[model samples]
Structure formats: structure tokens, C-alpha cells
Target: MAALMIQGCGSDVGKSVLVAGLCRLFTNRGYRVRPFKPQNMSNNAAVTEPDEQGRRGEIGRAQALQAMACRTPLSVHMNPVLLKPQSDVGAQLIVRGQIEASYQAMAYQTRKATLLDLVLDSFRRLEEEADLVLVEGAGSPAEINLRQGDIANMGFALAAQVPVVLVGDIDRGHVIAALVGAKAVLEAEDAGAIRGFIINKFRGDPELFDQGRREIVSRTGWPDMGLVPWLAAARSLPAEDAVVLRGAADGMRQRVRIAVPILRHIANFDDFDPLQAEPDVDLIYVAPGQPLPADSDLVILPGSKATLSDLAFIRAQGWDIDLKAHVRRGGCVLGICGGFQILGRTVADPDGIEGRAGSALGLGLLEIDTILGGDKVLEPCRGRIVDGQAVYEGFEMHIGRTTGEALNRPLLIREDGSGDGAVSADGRVSGCYVHRLFDAGTARAALLAKLGGASEGVDHRVAVDLALDEIAAVLETQLDIAALARLAGLKDIPT
Candidate 1:
């Protein structure tokens, strides 16, 4: 059966959410549906079950949400080529679940066509196996400059021969122009894929869009796919962009509030997501002007995409001073990934990895200094928590080598007999390059124990999973499930 493509007029135009809603909508109507993105550029990702016996890949937040909606196991092929942007120009490419290489914007553009086969293969597999395949297109197809060989939008639609439903965000206030312009700009043949157009993020009464919808249809000659009222519940959805979304904060030892300074290059900020699941803990973002929330008991410095730059920003905010005071006042401080580097000696970007000409001074917290190296650390690491710490076996994916610091009580000890991560003498100010520590139940329990909690009934992961289930229900209800199922042409499935 032919797939249904959710093409967008532009970025952030609600393609991902629409695809997700359609997936849930289809599933509710008794059809097994799946989500597919030919190519995704996101740093926030999930490791997926491999395909082709071992042709591995990474799962994305959108795909993860889809899987949870369809109630299927997550697989890497769902999103084959992921570009995790490390800097403004270049991104780390994860192909089939491995760091294949990194590419700059222009250099990568010419090379992207080579990936079309993999994206098609993955999409076709999902199409063949699932009852309905809901494919999402990236950006706008009217990008004629790139559309010549584009694999993300119209190029994908034409190649796959799928019917497209264009989406325009009304909240952006250019809904009509975005829709009509997209129609006017695309090649006559390229525009054939568009079956209809939908207006999303409608704020007021549905009838208010009657005239606007009529005008769009009159001008574009595209059928109306309904002006979807904004679903306020969408804010509860998990974020694929770490820049916009937040990590969870759970288990504070009462009267303990942790402040995590949002960084310019913050990566995997979702590390704190599970932490937010806790009822007793309060998580606050410490902006430069906003003095650290007065109630803050712990200050967390998160990972950054650019270690050197973010470290410099951290110090500039006088947060370095605030953090020092925090330590003096017997407050707790934790740093992760790039933040871990900042806590150590100077972050040297000698090769100009982070655009730095040379090495800079460290925070004088840990005895270590990190030199931005050529190799990137990307692997699932597991080990025992240092002699006694709140963290557990976690993963590490950073660039740079950390050396120095005392070893009595480490943050994590490798089962292979290597020691990594650092904790202070008082065990309050600590740093680790690992993310996902919050997802570790043992670590959460340990944190609660430290905070004087009777958290025996609190299972953080379970709470999150339940929230997902509720979200799935919401997606099933507000979305047009029956039409989406008919669109996918999936055969009936028994509940």
C-alpha cells in the first residue's frame, strides 16, 4: 500500500506532532500504524533495536513517541540517518547507530543524496511490515535550491509516490502565505504529491478559520484537511530538541532545590527528565540575570555541545562565583559531560574544535584537564558507582580526555577495571561525563536516600511510563484516527 506523507510548509510547522497524532489515531481505529522520518537532525535520540540482523541505527524522540503509541518495540531503522548538530555549521552523523562521520552544512548537502537508498530501504521495510506507514517530510519542498536532489521533502514524496498533506502553522501568522506560497513555488509536477493542506495551532473558535480555509483552498486549489484546534496537551509531549525541552528533576531531600544553568551548547539536557518525575524535588533553570533561585540547594551544570564556549559562558555569568559560594555554604554541585570538563582544568581547543585558538584555565575544582581530542566517546558504558555515590551504570558520549583527580571514591568504576568521573572530597561537588544517570533507578533511590526521603513507593521510571500511556490516550482521542487509518490503507486489526 502507498504511504501517507505529512509534508510541512516549513520547519516547526507541526510535522512531527501531526505524524504522532496520526499514528495514535490509526492505532485506536484498530490498525497497526508506524512512523517514519527519512532523515532527522536531532541530538536528543534513543538507541533502538537493530534491523537487517545487525544493520543498526539510532531511535529519535519522534519515533520513540510513535513506538509508544503503536505499542511496538523501538527500532533504529525508524530513523536511519541522524545528524546531531555539535556546532552551528557541522553535525555529528550517526549512520546505522554508529558515528560514521561529521559534516558541515554545505559539504554535507552534496553528500546527502548518497543516503537516499538507506532512507528508502528503511521506509519501505516499515511500509511492508506495518499496516500503515506515516512518513514525515522535513522543511519545505519549495526550497528549490536544494529540491533538485532533496531527500527530505518533495523529493522524498515523489520518490515514494505518497500522497502529501501540507501543514501550515497559523500561530506563526503567515499561514495563508506559507500555504499559498508553497503551492505557488513548487514545480507543477512536484506539487502533485500534495493531496490537501491543514492549518495547525488555531487559537480561537474553529469557525473563525472558515473564511481563511476557504481562501487557502480557493488560492492553492488544495483540499482542506481541517483546521486543527491547538492541542494544549502537546506541551506535555517529549522533546526531540534538547534546546527547547527540559530534563526531569526528582528526589530532593526536602528544602533542597537544584538549579541547572541553561547553557548555549547544552546537549542531552533531557538527562534531568526523570528527575522531574519526583514530587518532592524542584528543578529550576538559572538564567544569567536571575540570581540562582534562593531556595536552590544544589546547582547542576549540564553537558554542552561546545565545551570551551559553554565553559566560558558559565564563568561569565558569575555562576562560577555563585557555585563557589554554593560549595562554601555546604551546598551540592554536580556537573555532567562538558560541564564535567569545566569543573576541571582549562578546556583546550588547540585544534580549534570549539573555535578556540588555545587552552584556557580550568575551574580549579577537579585535578583534571581535558584537551579536545580527535576521537569522540560514543558508547553505552556500565560499571559500579564509585565506592559510594548516587549515580549508577550510565552511558558516555563526549569528545576529550579527562585526566587527574583523586581516586578514593570515584563516580563510576569500570567492570573492566578502569575508573572514570570525579567526586569531591566532601562528596558534594561531583562531575561526570555521563548522561542518563537519572534514568537509573538505583541512582534515583540513592539520591532520595541522601535527601532524607521515604521514597519506597516512588518508582520514577514507572511514573514516566504511565505519563506516556496517558499521552498516548490523548493522541488517540483528539486526532483524526479514522481518516488517518484510511489514509494509510492499513487492514483492520483486532484489539
Candidate 2:
């Protein structure tokens, strides 16, 4: 078995996307490939396949997408340690697909060393079943302050004996300095782990950067793996970080305008990827301090990692008033998981699972109340719009239970005859706990038709699959795939 790790000079340097492209590139070349991330920090997560006991776990959404690139089922081992941030200073820690505990930033720094064995164990398990494992490193190895108990970057690469390739985002500028600076700051052993360096997101003619490429190699003594151009296909893929949400809403006028008020702790924002991909629909993310657009046909309340906290944030931003006004103006309103809870009359946190043990008044859009304490529900399910034939499949991953009179007018009916969400008495407001609710073409089309627009009827899953292949094809021509294979001890791959 062979493995290679992709690390970056800093965050948002495209390490995850590069590893994903490589995973598909190698998998297309007839290799059994798997993806591994020693640790990940993001609220965007996906449910993995169930085990013998019918228990499903969650992993970082990027790892889940990489698994799709490899044509493999999702597994918890793909990401051993996941930190879902609930606040600025702390996060809820997940290990081996289960909630281990919550820890503050300072406390987690000291506690990471003990999980090295589990990270390695998961990597080896993937190696046992595949010819190659594409590993992704979080943040960067140049963070010497975090080098003490790091399990994500140099620490995991050195321990797993995996060759590393450093990636720098040229589009962010200082490509040469970023690559050389990483080598300069890293300790000797950590620096030696990097086998080569790749320049990513180059936006001009390749020949224009020849001198720059040579300078990076001349300074770092690492081989120039490749200079990849700006990959337009990447825009079609789901982004796992909240940073991407900034400036995401292009203000282009279209047939339908849907506005989502960006919550402070928004989670699973990618649930709207399908809607965003539609050419006739304009999906806008209303950031803090910005008023929700009055002209929008639909106002969507997105999922949040910290419900009560973001609920309070909503009120602070005066969006709660905007929503009430929207409903009064006869505009449509739809809420997602945490947003669904927020649409209710009350949201209570009895055990303090998310933050403080308290309760907050909801928006009162739906006649429901939610209590945020319980065994999290993480399972795949199939359902259809209540009294409609637009069937769809999605998953439920939440830690609260909601109930009330609105459920009597369910928005969706599961295949098992259970109601999934609620509908308003006026039929203008609705909410559900289902993530990826719009992935199905029929489902998206049905919802858009109600908003006085027509959907192109694109299947989001199929589009993502095609996008992965498009990225792999680009990497095939722009990258040194053969050299990357050689670095991973894979010598037989055709050039």
C-alpha cells in the first residue's frame, strides 16, 4: 500500500480540493483509492454508512466528497477527529464518528496528542483495503506554536510515514514566498517530510510564472510538481468551510430570488448548493448588519451549529423583525434543521448540550417547540412533499426533538408513514429537518415551481459527480501525476 499527504502553506490554500482531484485522478487510472484526514475542523459534516448495529456516524464533508471521488462508501475512519465549532473559543469534538466531548481551543491543544494512535489506526485500516490512500492535512505545518500535539499535518505525516506535497495558492499572491516560508519555519524533520511543492490556482499563462516556479524550487530545494490553473469546475463542488460563504451571494437578478440570512454559527450551508446551481435562481446570503432583501420571493432560514446562540444573534441583527415583515408581506419562508427549530415558538436547552442551559423564544412562524438535548439523530431517509409526488432522499443529523400543532399539517411524509416537518396554516411557511433536501431534480423543480419559477431540473448529485471528473481531467493535464505516484511509492502508473 502507498500513501501521500497534501499540506498547504496556510488555511484556504486549496489542500482539500487538490487531494480530492488527485483521488479521482488516481481512481480513474484503475487504482483502488481511499481518502484519509487525520483531523478536521468544520461544522459541515456528512453521515457515513451504518454498521452492523445500524448506527451511522458523521465525518467531515470534504472527506465524504473525496470518498465520492474514489467511488467508495462513506466511512468514519476517513476523518478520525472532527471539531465542530459552536463558539469562537470552543468546539464539540468528535472521534471515530461519535461525540467524544467538547473542549476549548487551549484545552484541545494539550489533548490532541493522545489521539495520534487512533488517527494512525484509521489510516492503516484504509491502507489495508486500498492500493493508495490520499491524505489531506488541515491548516499548515508552519504553525510551530501548534506543532506540540498536532495530529493534522507534519505530526501525522511523520508518524504515518507518508510522503508530503506542499500546495500554495498562487491566486492569493506570494506563491514563492509562501512555499519557501513554510520550509523556513518548519523544523528540520518536518521540512524533510515534504517531497515536492505544487502551485495551485494560478490564473495566467503558465509560461508567465516560469521564473516564479524556479524561484520556489531554488529556495526550498523541493521539486516543482506542477502549476495548476484556476479550476472553474471547483465552483460546482461543495465547499466545507464557512469562509466561502462570504461574498458567495452574487446579486444577479434572476427569475426567482431566495435570500438566506447568514447566521453566526451556520452549519451545513451547502444544503442550498442545488438551488444555487440553478441558472434561473439567485441565492443570496444576507450577512450580519445587512437587511434581508425586501424583493426576495423566498426567505430561507439555514441550519446552525449553535441554535440558541444564533437565534439570539438573529434577533440582535434585527432579522427576526425582517422575517416577521416578510411573512406579513405574503412572502414564503422555509427553515432547515436548526433554522427549523428557530421557526418554532420556543427552543429550550435543558442540559446545555450546545451552550448554556437556558431557553430562547423562537420566531413563531410554525406552531412547534424544540428541546435541544438528546441522542443525535443521524440517519438516511426517503420522503415526499406532503400530499405531493415529488419524492426525495436525504439525511437527518440533529440533537433536538420538535413537536406541536403545525406537525398536523406536515410538510413531508416519510416512507415509513412518519411526518418529518411542519407546514403553516396559511401554506406559506414550512420547515424540515432534512439536509440535502434539494438534491433531487424533481424535488428542486417542485419547490421552484411553487415560487413562480421554472427549474432546469438538474440532479445536484449527478452534477457533482461530473464536476469531480472534470477536475480530474484538468489535473491530468496540468499536474505531474506520474511524479506524484512515484513519490507515494507507486511506480507502475502509466504516464
Candidate 3:
């Protein structure tokens, strides 16, 4: 089986987007393509397609999007080692789609070496089925200090014997130095694994950087595979890292201003992408030390990796006060997953599932209470929006059970007649476990209409698909796809 890996000089250097574009580019050329990442560290996750025994697993949301680009079903094997951060120095480890254990930063370094076999096993399985697998390296291979047991980048590439194409972000400046310096710092064998380089997010005339590109090639002895211009379509896709959240919100005011307090450990933040895509909706990610916008039409408490911790974070930012005042002003509030748990009267983490064994007072916006400790619910579901005619479909990926008087009024009614979330008596406050709820056009439109904003009739899923194609078209012209295929040892790509 053929495969190639895309490694970047650093995080957010467009490695994920490049692999995604290539997946679509190759898939469009009639090849059976697949996306693979030996390891991923992110809170943004997605449930994979069910197995023969009807079991679903989780992978990074970026891998899920890349799977869509390949026109294939998501598989946990695509991202075998997922690190969902619970704190700055700790993360919950997932291996082969199942929660393994939690580890601190230093502790995980020792443990990662043991998982190489598992990562390789998953890669071999994917090789059995795909014509070509496009592997995405996490962070960067340039961090050679972590090189010993690193299954994420160079370690995985060398073990899998996959040739890599280095990607550098020109938009960040120092493009030539970044690319050449990486080759300089890497061990000789590791440097040999890199076959070529691509300069990403170039803004100006391509010719303006021609000499710069030559300098990188001259220094590193690697071919210049491509120089990709900044892609506006990338904004339509889900971001994998929270680092992107810095400077995330635009300064412009819009018809409907929705404020989202950026939780320290936010998860599945892509849930609001559809709303952000709407022209009339301005989704603001309120940072710490900043107050939630007073003129906001809605305040959405986003999904959190650590519910109890983030609930305290809300209080720390004084957003708890802002939220109550917003509700008093007749503004709407919505929460999903951990955010849903935070809306209730109390959140109990008895088994210490997400830190200490204790309970804390919730925001008291809803009558419900949540107990964190249960088998995680991971399944695709569809239902009617309670109190509205709009039908919605999304996945449920959360751990815990909620109950309260608010259950008397559900936010959604699953097709199986089971309720999924709580609705406050006044209806201004609500919460649910379903992620991607707004992807449903009717539901999005209904919610926006209630917020006094027009939806513009955009089908978010279709728009994402179009965005993938748009990205692929740009890559097809900008990048040397034929050279990449050749590097992967494929016979000439189908014209």
C-alpha cells in the first residue's frame, strides 16, 4: 500500500488543511484515499462510523473532516492515539478508540513508546483497505527533543517508512529560515525522511517568493513541492487546536451578536461553526478577563473537556454574572455537552472522572442536575427540536446523566421518544448533549429566527463539502499533485 505524510514546521502550519485538501484532490481523481494520524492532541473529537458489532469510537475532529474529504467513513484507526487535554500538563489518553488512561506531560513521554506497535497495527489495517493513506503529523517534527518515543511525527514516519513533505507557514514570516532550520536541526536519518517542502499561506504574488523558495531548496536539498496561497475556504472547516481561538473572533458588529465565553478546556467548539458561517450572525469568543458582550443576542456555553473545571472558569471570568444579567435582559442561552452540565443546578463528579471527587453549584439557569460518571454515550441520532417544527440530526458523545424538574420540558425529542436535554420554564435557557445540532438547516434557521437574525438559507454541510472541493481545486493548481503522488510511489495519477 502507498502512503505519504505531511509534517509541518510547527502547529497550525496548515498540515491538517493540506492533508484534507490532498485527500479530496486524490479522491476526486478516482483513487480510494484515506487519512491517518498516528497521534493527535485535541479536545475537538468526533465519533467514528460503527463497527460490525455496532460500536462507535472517537477520533480528532480534523481526522473526521479528512475522512469526509476522502468520501469514506470515519474510523478510530485514523487517529489511534488521541490526547484530550484535561489540564495544561495532563491529558486523557485514548488508544485504538477506547479510553486508556490519563497521564501528565512528562509521564506520557515514557508511555508513548509503548504505543508504537498499536499505532503501527492501525496503520497496517488502513493500508489493507486504502489505495493511498495521507498521514497528518501532530504539532511538528521539528521538536526533536520529543523525538525518542514520539509516535506523532518523525517517529511514526520513520517507523512506517512513509516519506514526508514538510509544510511551512509563510504567512507567519521567516519561511525560508523555518524550512531550512528544521532540516538543520533534525538528525540526518530523520531529515532524509523528508522528500520535499511546501510553503503554505502565501498571500502576495507567487513570483515574489520564487527566489525565497529556491533558497530553501538550496539549503535543505529538498524539492519545492508547492507554494499554496492563503485559502479563505479554510475558515469554513473545523479547527483542531484551541490555539486558533486567540484572535478568533472578529471585531465587527453584526445583526445578531452571539457571545461564547472561551472555556480554558473547551471541547467540540466546532459546534458553533454553522452559526459563525451565517452572515447576520457574529459569533464572539469572549476571552478571560473580558466581559461577555452586553449587547449580545445570545450567550452559548460551549462544550468543555473538564466540566467542573470550566464551570469554575466561568465563575472566574465573572461570566456567571454576565450570563445571569443577559438572561434577565431577555437574551437566550444555549449549552451543549459539558456546557449543558454547567447550566444545571449542580454538577457532581463523584468518581473523580474529571478531577476531584466532589460536586459544585451550577449556574442555576435550568432546574436539572448532572452526575459525571457513566459509560460515554456515542451514537448518531436525529430528533425534533422540542417546541419547534425543525428536525435535527447529530451525534451524542458525552459521559454522564442529567435529571431534574426541567426534564419536564425537553430541548429535543429523539426519534425513539427519549428526551435528550433540558429546557428552562421560561424557554430562554436550554441545554443539550448533541453536538453539531446547528448543522441542520431548519433547526439553525429556527434558532436564528428566534434570535432576530436571518439564516441566509445556507446548508452548512453542503457548504463544507463545497469548501473541501474549493480547497482541492486551489491545491490542484498551486501544488504539484503529480510530484506528491510520485513521492508516494503511486503510478501516474488518473488525469
Candidate 4:
């Protein structure tokens, strides 16, 4: 019956990282612990663990990290509402472990009460089963405007009667102001629910806060948990969002270098995880500030929730200019999902399905036009590269329908007529809706040749499972497990 909520002073203030730390902390103590976020507005999400009845829910990466910390099977009930960005003002809503529908912020706000009902239902289920549920709040509850349908923070706190531990990022200059403002922003009733506070990501000496800590406790009347310094290896946790999942390619090949054009809304970029399993290849992320390396063996344009918008940004950065030059120089390019959409001639959002103003131009690399399709395609795929340069199979999730004369040039072939990706003639560049091409041995080998990535002898799944277990082990090492049991109020139960 013990539950604690973690709410941040603001977005990207390390709330996700804090829950990840606590997940390990509580799990090490031998108590069963889980993570919860009543509603999460993130494109990053995890496929839930199957229950006895084989049920599935839409838990975000935060919960996945917690489950990994506990070394437990992930559960669907951990997150009840998952909102994936489809456009600037619109989101695709997933409630109680399933896709509900896409809605604009205005429409979503109107249905906030209904969303809260779903959140409460998920919490009740977790309360019935787990020893601890560490809930994570989205954005800030201090924004009184959104609190009306607020299942994410204070509203959930009040409904579940869960104790909260507000976390402030000292790395940000507004730590004191954020803490004080939080106390002032909430109604007295909501503010009283915060039982304690923690300062995260401190760089200097911990004692520097000796005086500051006292002042905060005196001002907010909340106890101090601890000022936690940054954990350098925090990246070991399973990445719920693909953007945070990259590491240098582990290939042993000395000459291999790959450039990844970091899409603004990259989704499931974890498909590249095994590339990091090798020891030889160097992985470099190509962001807005830098140009794609012409000398690099390959360039990758990853998936995106908003392909058209990202395409515009890519053009703004003049990356499209660089991409054309890289292609002419014989450097290979790979596109996935929205990346696939962008490679086409144009992207049409006739219905404003993706929340953009209207139809938009694409990167015009692949000779195709992608129409925004209402039906979302989600399925694991398998394929064979008919041509010499490419072949792989993975999952596909997108809202665009691509049409092209060259679309029939499949990179891989399965027993089924179509598998995952398609290849064009000459095969210098190719595209797919799949996320993890590195997962396939044949595929990886082919791509390594193009990207100069080195390969490991291990199968992709074995490597992935090993990496996941390794991350889970970190939770055991850093967390105060026994302390968590006491905090969860489950210290007396038989292990």
C-alpha cells in the first residue's frame, strides 16, 4: 500500500532520470517496485509486459527503465495514457494500454476528466498488485491552467493520496525559485502533499548546500531526501525514447565512421543499439550545427513523428544540400519511417492529419510522395535484400502511404511477397519503415559495408537481451533497496 509520486519543477528537469534512479534504489532492496505515469506526452513508449491473461498496455520508457531496474517483466498498467506527437498541436492518444485516437490539445483538454478516470483505473490495478509504484508527473503541476484535467501531477496525488517527492535540478539556475514557486503555485491543499524534496544533478561539493538546504526546508516545510550527484553511467538504463539510446558503434574496424542526422522527433532510434555493440566503428550524431561528413561511409536519417516538419528543419539546416552532396560522393544514406517519408518527392497532409498547415515538400531523394494516411501501420517485419547493397527486417509504425515506381525494389524478401524495406535501382541509397535494421545479421553486414560499421559475431537479440540485463544490474548497484522497502512500507513482507 505504499506509493510515492515524483513531480519535477519543469520539463526535462530530470524527472525521468530521477524515477530511473529510484527504480534501481527500490529494486535493490528486494521489494517489488514499478513506475507509473498517469499520462505521458511523449513519442517514446515501451511495449508492455504480457500479463497472465496476455494483456498489453502502453507504458513509456520511464516505466521500462524501472522494470529493468527491478529486473522484472514490464507491465502495461505502469502507464495508462501515452500521447505521441503527430504534429505541433496534435497528439496520438493511447489509453489503458491501447491506441485510443489522435486529438488536438484543445480536444484533449476537453476530455481531461475522462482521461483522469483512465489514469485512476490503472493506478488501482497497480495498487492491487505491486509492492511499490513510483509515479512520475509530466511537465509541471504549477501551471494551474492545465490542472483541471490533471491526472499527471497534483490531481493524481490528491486522488491516490500518494506522497510526493519534488525534484529540482540544481544544474538549472532556477532551483530555489522553482522550489519556492512550486510551493506558492499550488493551492495549499495540493502543496501539503509534497512530503520531501531532492536536489538532482549537482556538480560541486554536496556541502555547498548546507545552508541552502536548511532554508528550503524552512521555507517549504518539506523534508530533504538527499542531493544526488549525476550518475555518469545513467545511460545504462533501457531507453524508452530512441533519441537517448545512442552510443559509439562497438565495431572493431578502425576505418568505419557513420553519420546519423538526428531528426528532431526521432522515434525508436534504439534500432541502432547493436551498432554500439561492436568495438571498431565510430558512431557520430549529425545535429543541426554540423554537416554530414562526406568522407564518412554512410549517413542515416532516422524515424520521426513529424516527417514534414522535420524535413523543413533539415532543409533549414542545409542538411538537404549536404545529403545530396554525400549521395553524389557515393556515401550511402539510409532512411526509416518518417525518414522514409522525407526521402520522397512530397508529403501531403491534406486533412491536416499530421497537424501541419498543409501539404509540404519532402527531401525529394527517393522519387515518392507520401500521403498522410489515417490508418497507422504497426507490425514486425521481415525482408530480404534482392540487390547487393542492402537487406533487413524490423518493425514499422507510421501514418504515411508511400507510392513510387521504384517501391517494388525490396531490400529483403520473406515468405510473404513484401517484407520490410524497399531498394531502388543501383542501390546506393534505400529506405524502410522498419526501425532496427542492425538486428539482422545479413542486414547489419550489408549496412556495415556501406556505413563502415564493424560487426559483432553475436545475434542481435542476444546482444539486446544482454544489454538490457546489464542495465538492470546497474539498478541493483546504485539503489538503496532496503531503504526503498522501508519507504514503500513493505519491509515486513517475506521475500
Per-prediction TM-score to the true structure, in the order listed:
0.82, 0.99, 0.98, 0.81
Ranking of all candidate structures by their TM-score, best first: 2, 3, 1, 4
Residue 483 lDDT (model 4):
47
Once fitted onto the true fold, the runs of candidate 1 whose alpha carbons sit more than 4 angstroms away are 27-32, 50-59, 142-145, 242-255, 277-279, 288-295, 346-359, 369-394, 406-408, 412-420, 440-442, 445-479, 493-495
Please state every model's RMSD to the true fold in angstroms.
Answer: 4.2, 0.9, 1.1, 4.5
In order, the Cα lDDT scores of the candidates are 0.72, 0.92, 0.91, 0.71
Q: Which pairs clash inside model 2?
A: none
What is the Å distance of residue 198 in model 3 from its true position? Answer: 0.4
How would you encode candidate 2's per-residue C-alpha lDDT over 226-284 as one tens digit per residue?
A: 98889899998999998988986668888999999889899999999999999889999
- lDDT (Cα, 0-100) at 434 in candidate 4: 70
Give residue 59's lDDT in candidate 4 (0 to 100). Answer: 58
**Tens-place lDDT digits, model 4, residues 1-495:** 778888988876778767766665556656677778888877765556554465555457677666665567767678877888776678878776566777888999887677777688778887777778888998888888888878889999999888887888888777888898899888998999887887777787879877887888988998777776765555433455444534432233356777777777776666666665556666677666667776777777888877777888898889999988988887777787788778778888886655654777777677677898676665556666655534465556667688886587755666476544555566777787776667777767766755545576455755444544554454444334444445456647433
lDDT of 3 by residue, 366-415 (tens): 99899988888888899989877788888989888998999889889999
Candidate 4 Cα RMSD after full superposition onto the native fold (Å): 4.5
Backbone collision tally, model 4: 22
Query: What is candidate 3's TM-score against the reference?
Result: 0.98
